[model samples]
Target: MNNTTHLPVNPYLPAPLALPLSLVPGKTYSQVMARLLNKLFGPELADGELDFLEGKIMRVDVVDAKLHFSITLSQGVLAAADTKCPHDLSIEGSIYDFLLLATRREDADTLFFNRRLRLGGDTELGLYVKNFLDALELDDRIGPFLQMMNGATTLIGRIPRLAIPKLPFPKLGRRS
Candidate 1:
């Protein structure tokens, strides 16, 4: 006689991405993040989430006359430096959040206004970095990573929906 046993399902366990959830911005952000990390960090560094940043940092310190970027990684941190314009940036929110929001080209103005994102160091530097990230098309390099991610999600019987958050316009009177 043969006996077959079935495993019980747990709802708490993240549901599979099979149904292709609604068009949510968070998903788009995730994809961009994967691309940036793959391009900037490399494949070897793709161990875990925080692992990508370990011991890696390139600080813009300052860029242009109105921007400043403080790039920090698990490897190192770089602060944008500028003399003409000064910026007061605080590193409070999750770096993951900043990275995600920064990838959405042409969304910085809205991002800053809605406070969906924040910057550390010079404001101009941050803007410049945002612009740079927007122009970068990590697709060629990021495709494989994204494929792997989607494959893994699919293997578990789920569908992934690609979406990026909609940033709000910045408030007036704030330094650009």
Candidate 2:
């Protein structure tokens, strides 16, 4: 028999956002994710925290979105592939789970233990990548952007389901 303690379901937890997979072109998704990753890792590389990733490729697979991309640190620059590429390690998880990790709503150990996230490929490289992310201080690196993203996520979670449109639409209001 399994002896693992299952986490209790929380009533207050927000339902996962439904992605308009059909509407978003595959190329667009890849470009957007790549840009985001580059932005995220740029400062880390500049600070030398990601020196361990030099010459190594790490792939992140968003299972639900059917999206995967690889990133490598070379010559002190972090570059993300526009499409799938050979990787030394891969991390797979749902977008929601990844977002939770990024926003600090969940820890890597808890997610990994619960099987919400999985790692594969080179074990040593994977462990190194995991440890790097675990030790990252997002606030020190991308404080304003991280804070804004977290705030947006929290605001979306608080909105009533009935108030949200079934289809997402661009707000044509004044731009901030």
- By TM-score, the best candidate is 2
Distance (Å) between predicted and true CA of 151, model 2? 4.9
Candidate 1, 1-176: lDDT as tens digits: 76975432211112233123322333343344445545564543444433333433333221111222333343432222232333333322222234333333225555456544556655654554556555555556667765655454334333222346899988779676
TM-score for all models, in order of appearance: 0.32, 0.65
Top candidate by lDDT: 2
The residue pairs found clashing in candidate 2 are none
Worst 10 residues of 2 by lDDT: 8-17
lDDT computed for candidate 1: 0.40
RMSD of each: 20.6, 11.6
TM-score for predicted model 1 compared with the true structure: 0.32
- Least accurate 10 contiguous residues by lDDT in model 1: 59-68
> Candidate 2 residues 70-148, lDDT tens each?
7677677666644445677789876656777888888888888887889888988877777988887767777787887
Residue 139's lDDT in candidate 1: 59
Candidate 1 segments whose C-alpha is farther than 4 A from its true place = 1-106, 147-176
Q: How many backbone clashes does candidate 2 have?
A: 0
